[model samples]
Target: MKFITLSNGVKMPILGYGTFTMSNDETERCVTEAIQVGYRLIDTAQAYRNEEGVGNAIVKCGVSREELFITTKIWVENAGYEKAKRSLEESLKKLQTEYIDLVLIHQAFNDYYGTWKALEEAYKSGKVRAIGVSNFYPDRFMDLVTFSEINPMINQLETHVFQQHKNDKKFLEKYGTKLEAWAPFARGSHGIFENEVLMQIAKQHNKTIGQVALRFLIQNGIIAIPKSVHKNRMEENLNIFDFSLSNENIKKIEELDLGENVFMDHENAEDIERFFKMFKIGNK
Candidate 1:
């Protein structure tokens, strides 16, 4: 596995396993298999409600706590200095660890500034090695970095071939924050798996389209956490380090970028309303 050093000098695996929308039982089972398949970074969230499952897998995976990188997020409902701090404690207990490798504010909603303060405190207290935010767009991201005491070490977004987030990447560069892709596959949207460009590249490298997609992101210095319930797919996702994509091949794939988010648009008010409804935080 490859590693990237965050602004704070913490080395993080370039690839990781994300457990979103997973039940506790599914998270435990899949996380166990993912670890067996050689994944060291495990991302969970308070919204996912499966940190306990991740904890179970941690104890069961037979890997030492020091060797694994565990990440969890503060949900919108837990978005305050007190609430977020309390949530972190709960997450640490659920993850069965004294210190988390990373902790991110799950979204830009609620009192994220307060949540960030909580994370900052957690970082100073040695409870978390790194702190970041998820789903924050450029404007909001810049605002936070400008005002915050500590710049974010990372920002997780819905990055994929279709929505490459090139502008965001460049913007984050100014702050020395690494860009991470949450839905690195775009959840298989936009015919990503069957795209001729990715297909051709995969054929050239004797790899799968998913592997090529992830390789593209990782090659561009973006951290990717692709999730799969199947062990074979999990293994396939991790087997992206063997070959390299040529510059010409990268250009072909780069043309595949539509340069806009194919998923939820965080900048759109209508989309934000829908998101709130979906997450049942409309009243928040």
Candidate 2:
């Protein structure tokens, strides 16, 4: 398991187990299995509503708290300083941890600056070891980095073979902020699994297209979290350490870049409206 040291000097795994849409029972079971299969970093979010399940897995996994790197997000509904802080406290209760390894402002919506301030305070209080943002496009990413007392240590993006996020990587490099990919597979869309370039590379190394895809990101110094409900896929995702992709093949995979998002777009008006509605309901 390779690690990348954030600007703040904390080491984060280059790969992690993502628990985005897992149910309570699924989060608990898959997280347990992930740990047993040697995954130390578990990603969850308050919006996922499975923090309790993740917490349950942490308690029951029989792994010491220190060995695990737990990350969660402050949902859009929990924006603002007080709401964000209180929500993290609730997350702590749900996650069964005294301190989270990383806590990200889940979206750029609402009072994220204020939400970031809460994260900053939490960092000072030793309640969180690292702070970051997710789905923060370049404009918002730079805005937060410029005004914050402590720079964001990570920015999780919608990255995959098609949306390589090259420009974002260069921008993050300027601030010493790290990059993490949320959907490293493009969710199997855009013919990612069936691509000729990727297929050829996978054949050369006797690896699956998924493994080749993950190796490409990890090699490019990007941290990625690929979620899977199956134990076999979980293990396969973890098995990319032994082989290295050639620069020639890396260049081939780079050709797959389309510079577009495969999933939700933050700039979409409907998406923005959805965020507002989701939070408005939460306030009630």
- TM-scores for the candidates: 0.98, 0.96
lDDT of each prediction vs. the true structure? 0.92, 0.92
Q: Score residue 171 of candidate 1 by CA lDDT.
A: 86
Residue 199 displacement in candidate 2 (angstroms): 1.0
Judge candidate 1 at residue 240 and give its lDDT: 95
Tens-digit lDDT string for candidate 1 (1-284): 99999999999999999999899999999999999999999989999999999999999899998889998999999998999999888998988889999999889988999999999999999999999999988778988998999999999998999888888899898998999999999998899888999998899889999999999999999999999999999999999999999999988988888877876888788988888888899455
Q: Per-residue lDDT for 254-274 in model 2, tens only?
A: 988998886677778887667
Number of the predicted model whose TM-score against the real structure is largest = 1
Off by over 4 Å in 2: 274-284
Could you list the CA RMSD of all candidates, in the order they appear?
0.9, 1.6
Q: Which stretches of candidate 1 lie over 4 Å from their true place?
A: 282-284
Model 1's alpha-carbon lDDT is 0.92
